[model samples]
Target: MTVIIGHNPNFVPFNGRGTLRHNEPLSKHTSWRIGGPAEWFYEPTDLEDLAQLIPQIPDNMPMMWMGLGSNLLVRDGGVRGMVILTAGLLDDMIFLDEYTLRVEAGVSCAKVARFAVNAGLTGAEFLAGIPGTMGGALAMNAGAWGSETWAIVQGVETMNRQGQHQRRSVTDYEVRYRHVKGPDNEWFVAAVLKLLPSTIEEGQEKIKALLRQRGESQPMGLPSCGSVFRNPANDYAARLIEKAGWKGRGVGGAYVSEKHANFIINQKAATAADVEALIEQIILSVEQQSGVRLIPEVRIVGEYATTKPFMSETPSS
Candidate 1:
């Protein structure tokens, strides 16, 4: 297989029943409203379509799987190969039984929470505050309010690059805080989650409360990734950043959110480079001041832009 950089005219044509486009802008898909273009972007209509399409691409071509695009940063230079967008394309949610729900990777986390509640289930209320999809939640073990995604997972369905599917038990993977490791070269396609019984009113009330708390604490209605840094063991990332006096600091259009120190807001027209620079600054400053290095919870990818110069001004707090 030959590796091609950008816009390969010799790439294999897709014959799936989904949308496929060349040089698709990623900014329209992400929560942060940032990113450049993808060399090849495909949105599969269903699991079958995705499986059929995977094997058509050359093995050497790069591939990236994305959900709602929270907790992600794509560089201005854009992605080089194929990007498979699952949000709104692979959506399928159904109850496997009275106590279990089968959710596809493209279903939003908030929708899953509401669906679980509508089914009189209790444990998924925490998912109401998550901004991404079920696939991302499962991949990162995304959690909030002390409840994690994997705790309720019974089993998962995965698809490899060869268009093959496998059903895997929860015990097949090693689950951790904001991390999960299972079979290599495979991505989650669906999951069966087990939940406890509860009244609809009770579950709705919990979800409402969680959303209210998130609205008040987070930078609501802003162009920003939810959280930039993971809380280190026995210490909060926000606390360290605030203590180190980084709150409301700005680099180009990206600024450390005044409301939440761990959040970097695109105040106005912030580029991906600005966000990355601010992230680096926070990491360096927090590590120097608190003697603890902060790890970014958000995933950063793609190549740096060679055309633009980084701005030097810092915005007002």
Candidate 2:
């Protein structure tokens, strides 16, 4: 039996072991610390709990997945649907073999890198510099230090909206730089990675070097989504923005980082509209000057503050 709560038809109460919240502030979950509330937020306790809760959601209600919340921008009007948070709740990591490891979606990329290194594995050292969860990394093929998440992926387990699970191989999807296209209506639950055998000291050294390079280049202390735009073919996004003289440009409280032109930082109380406006301004100016139309790498979601009520029809209690 399903219980409808409050006046919102989409606000169905979850009876699972996980935590459920209504009107949760999305800014608290994102790296940029900018966004409106989420209509519904659910954090599953484990894989089994997640599977059980999937089918309980209303068919027409929208849903979205979140991890460490990097490379994401939620608009000011907030999300209209359920937001399933998998950051600390789906945490599970184990080795399938000497060189193969299985990591759940909630595991942080840094944790995966450290775990692999401690087990004397290489190739995952670059993950130490990625500031998101493994799930988010997989979704966007996140990369750092010249390596990508999908490069080491051997297989993955995905869960559909109907509480069904499927195991898929690398060939099941088209993986590109900072983008991935896979079976529709399925979200990744876990991934199997194959890494090269290496000494712990070696992996540690590589991770240290990568972190140093990132710290030197990025504004690590600021509230910003790591990279706002993807590099165009044969050129870098940061280079183009800097060449176009867009560094330190501001729109409201949001400004293009002078340290790295590809990053837009929130100095104080920056709204989603502010950041978005800044992004558009940069894109227009850069295209006008460099003839290269830069594409945003950040995943922008939710409704604009000016949009009408997402759910107008009230459900009878």
Candidate 3:
């Protein structure tokens, strides 16, 4: 990890609680390895430090939150203001009551699954294949093999940009497939999950099977967002993409995985522009051919260049 302290000119070096970097390369943070610099990148040391820093930032300055970058894309021009990266912070995991667990936002989905299984929890086995953090899983209602993040949700802890906190129930948010809409300007910091009881052996075998399925069907070795498009109702995005003959197509360095048509991989040196162009093209093609507009599962942010890459050419998939 690239850690540079006191690098941003606008950085206010308070106590030694966290690290700050100016013009931090977001490419280093995202899964695609393809983004420009962030004006100010802040990684809090802990949840306490993060909450403390939240209400102190300038009101005029903009901010964004992100996880492990498994399903996100930042444009080549980069983010303009502070990016509060939670990928490294908020990783506290504790087993609570017999049927409940407390997982901080930064904990990876895979870890949550393993921890739950070790404690003899059964419902979280589906999370073993998700590539992002629990916070991201919460944001997107991430799931696999018929289980969703919100399906097992019990209660969630949230904090507004202003540092105001709230403990909300599952009903507090409008949850859907690949979507979660809740309070404005409030992001997840932690969650309390209710799960079932099972033996560690059962959990381990289930996780292994899920992982094996993912490895066989997805491009695990390449750098790519886990899934580029949400599966449409009654159908899969991969099916639509393949029906449109989009498998192995690409924009610059970004190519659709042969293993799964819905995934875009960075074959070599992929730019954010390259990935964005590919996504737009795929959306257009799929919609034109099938009369269905596929919504992006990937969260795209930041600004793109006025001119695009030489995307008319293709890269070898």
As for TM-score, the candidate ahead, 1 or 2, is 2
Candidate 3 structure, TM-score to reference:
0.92
Clashes of 3: 0
Model 3, span 204-307: residue lDDT tens: 99999999999998988789998899999999999999988889989899999999998999997988889988999999999999999999999998877553
lDDT of 2 at 36: 79
Candidates by TM-score, descending order: 2, 1, 3
What overall lDDT, based on C-alpha atoms, would model 3 receive against the true structure?
Answer: 0.85
- Per-residue lDDT of 260 in model 2: 93
Candidate 2: tens digits of C-alpha lDDT, residues 76-130 = 9889878999998788999998999999999999999999999999999989988
Q: What residue runs in model 3 are displaced by over 4 Å at the alpha carbon?
A: 1-16, 306-317
What TM value does model 2 have? 0.94
Order of the predicted models by lDDT, top scorer first: 2, 1, 3
Instruction: Give all candidates' CA lDDT scores.
Output: 0.88, 0.89, 0.85
Best by TM-score: 2
Off by over 4 Å in 1: 1-12, 307-317
Residue 273 error, candidate 3, Å? 1.0
How accurate locally is residue 300 in candidate 1, as Cα lDDT from 0 to 100?
95
- lDDT of candidate 1 at residue 237, scale 0 to 100: 96
